[model samples]
Target: MATDELAGVQSVESVQSETTTKRYPVAPGVQLNVRSGPGTGYPVVKVLPTGVSVPINCQCPGTTVAGPYGTSNIWDNIANGQYVSDAYVRTGSDGYVAVRCG
Candidate 1:
């Protein structure tokens, strides 16, 4: 995919609050690993498949977007807009519902 394509994906807004606007990534083949805790050092969370776009609720306590293998991000939901977990988030723009992919 082109770099510009990923730009459309939701970017994290520095100032976040109950009324703050939020965004999430949605890309195909976006690999994600839901960690037991904030950082690494636990079992993975189902190895999410491609097109599986997680929501970004809020930013993690101490996490960055720079990494070698997978992408780490904090997300929430579109309906509730609640920040939940810190999982491996990919830069995409689609796929909220689960669909069989090869």
Candidate 2:
């Protein structure tokens, strides 16, 4: 392929990686609650099945919670208006993994 074409392909791959959604495993044996907001005070929008992984779109601080991983106030936004406690997510860190929600 021509140099320009190869460069374009490489550029596309770079963008794809940057925009790709990253999924994190939930704590074992837990049917996690998906809340409307970043806290327990928010109503449960749904429940995630056991052994499921979730893509955290963003993170924000909210009600502190204790879970299998540890205690934390960071909530992961899995979708629009949907959030789960980061404490239950095995993100390998005790702090925010994704960009803070705008």
Candidate 3:
């Protein structure tokens, strides 16, 4: 391939890598709820299947919850308008694992 074409391919690969978010495992055997907002007070939008992993787009403070990991107020934004309590996700940290949501 020509040098320019190679450079273009490399640039595309770099962008793709940066956009690929890491998926975190949910607590074992739990059908976790996906809330509309960051807190439990928000309505449930969906329920994650047991043993499913989720990619956290961002995190924000929310209602405190206790899960297998521990109690926390951090909520993970898996998708637009979809959130799950960070306490249920094994992000290997008791704090925020991604950028804070706006």
Candidate 4:
């Protein structure tokens, strides 16, 4: 029982750590696009100039595309409601680097 409880706690901690906001820079000259939602289908909300460092709030799976980080579908939440493809940022993780957005 103790082991099971400890395992549960560890799982929660992992999830919490994944959700922790992380700072990342826009790939140089990418002029990354911000979307209202997590996909290209979503309207382009804004554009961030190159070298802008943003706080990644979370991430969710979105449209896949080849980018500075190679091909990926993960979209990162950079602001309150703004999202940009994780593929365009240099997170160094080709896989999901943050907890999926709810």
Ranking by TM-score: 3, 2, 4, 1
- TM-score of each candidate? 0.37, 0.83, 0.86, 0.76
lDDT of 2: 0.96
Residue 22 lDDT, candidate 2, scale 0-100: 90
**TM-score computed on alpha carbons, candidate 4:** 0.76
Least well predicted 10-residue stretch by lDDT in candidate 1? 93-102
What tens-digit string does per-residue lDDT give for candidate 2 at 4-101?
A: 99999999999998779899999999999999999999999999999999999999999999999999999999999999999999999998889999
Please report the TM-score between candidate 3 and the true structure. Answer: 0.86
How does candidate 3 score on lDDT?
A: 0.96
Q: Tens digit of lDDT per residue, candidate 4, span 1-102?
A: 699999999999999987676788878888988999889999998999888887778889989878877888889998877999888888878887777789
lDDT of each: 0.40, 0.96, 0.96, 0.86
Worst 10 residues of 4 by lDDT: 17-26
Higher-TM-score candidate of 1 and 3: 3
Off by over 4 Å in 4: 1-20
RMSD of candidate 4 to the true fold?
A: 6.7
Q: What's the true lDDT of residue 102 in model 1?
A: 13
RMSD of each: 15.4, 3.3, 2.7, 6.7
What residue runs in model 1 are displaced by over 4 Å at the alpha carbon? 1-23, 63-65, 68-102
- Scored by TM-score, the top model is 3
Clashing pairs in 1: 26-92, 26-93, 27-92, 27-93, 55-75, 55-76, 56-75, 56-76, 57-75, 57-76
Overlapping backbone residue pairs in candidate 4 total 0
